[model samples]
Target: MKTLWVLVIAWASVAPAASMPVCSGGHRVNCVVDGDTFWWRGKKYRIADIDAPETDASCEAERRLAAEATSKLKDLLANDFAVEPTGRFDRYGRRLVIVKIDNKSVGETLIAAGLARRWQGRKEHWCPAP
Candidate 1:
């Protein structure tokens, strides 16, 4: 009985290493990397399910938009926002989080602003299908 109790305690103390939980707590943290990619809670995060133009992609306008979107995101966050994970991870192994600041979604904002396009498939670049 004592051995079982000790084992249970040990297991309880171990934090889950895979699949981050959805944002349940109200506590917010600082943005360490705000350039299209960011980190929080000792975990590196990337916006999931969206593909923005790359800085050097085929489309010159898109590339510029990518940079602009990145900059805008940084400005919008700027240590004044809260985020919640969608309970998913991207291909790069970065924790995918749905961000909100002042009850506004930063991703949707970029989309509405024509800064980013919806991810067609599961890749990092945006491409339209025929």
Candidate 2:
């Protein structure tokens, strides 16, 4: 029937529009929010598969490491980089992504540098207990 054909066409047109936005090509790094997060083209992104010390750290050692992590991440993002989405989002609504600088994962770089740790479904302390 003509009506059925029209309905089918309308549905098909709307389906693509309703799909989730994909970040494939990547975005320019606008600024680093912290060690594990950054802002890109007005969107907040969290580094995937890694966790860094909180900027508002509780202890002196943690605070120092947090600052170091932030600085290191900033330096990395200063170069040409791309963000590949992990098909996930954090609780804070940040897009989870693996930041690649010169084709190398920034998260892995930070981990190797002792600036961050691999995320294991939970946050761990960056400073040893007293």
Candidate 3:
């Protein structure tokens, strides 16, 4: 019983940051860039599991959906969450991470809500090309 309990506790601490660091020393304020990107303590992180519509969307529908996804992302980040580094970075130089809340993926939440899609090796269009 004791060994089992210890293992459970240890596993829990291995991931989930609990809370991201706040801004200090005059760095940029922490904020979400889009559904799958955010800034924390002056560093940018791209969510590794999903690809959301770009803010500069090509179509009106895409633009609107992008805004909705961005808003949803903002609200989700307001509560307790975790940022688990993926040991990789995007071409734009943003560190990649998997953000989770209580072990549930933030990306999956957005996907369920029709706000985002699973990321493939390359970005898939949010809408048909113009």
TM per candidate comes to: 0.61, 0.76, 0.78
For every candidate structure, what is the RMSD over all alpha carbons to the true structure, in angstroms? 10.7, 10.9, 4.9
Query: What lDDT, from 0 to 1, does candidate 1 have?
Result: 0.58
Locate the minimum summed-lDDT window of 10 residues in model 2. 13-22
Better of 1 and 3 by TM-score: 3
User: In candidate 3, which residue ranges exceed 4 Å CA deviation?
Assistant: 1-27
> Where does candidate 1 have its weakest 10-residue lDDT segment?
12-21
lDDT of 1 by residue, 45-69 (tens): 7665455666656766656676777
C-alpha local distance difference test of each model:
0.58, 0.76, 0.78
lDDT of 2: 0.76
lDDT of 1 at 120: 64
Clashing pairs counted in every model: 0, 0, 0
| lDDT tens readout by residue for model 2, 1-130 | 9999986554321111111222234563366777898777667889988999987788888888888988888777766676777778999999898877666888999999999999999889877888
As a whole number from 0 to 100, the lDDT of residue 106 in candidate 2 is 85
Provide the lowest-lDDT 10-residue window in model 3: 13-22
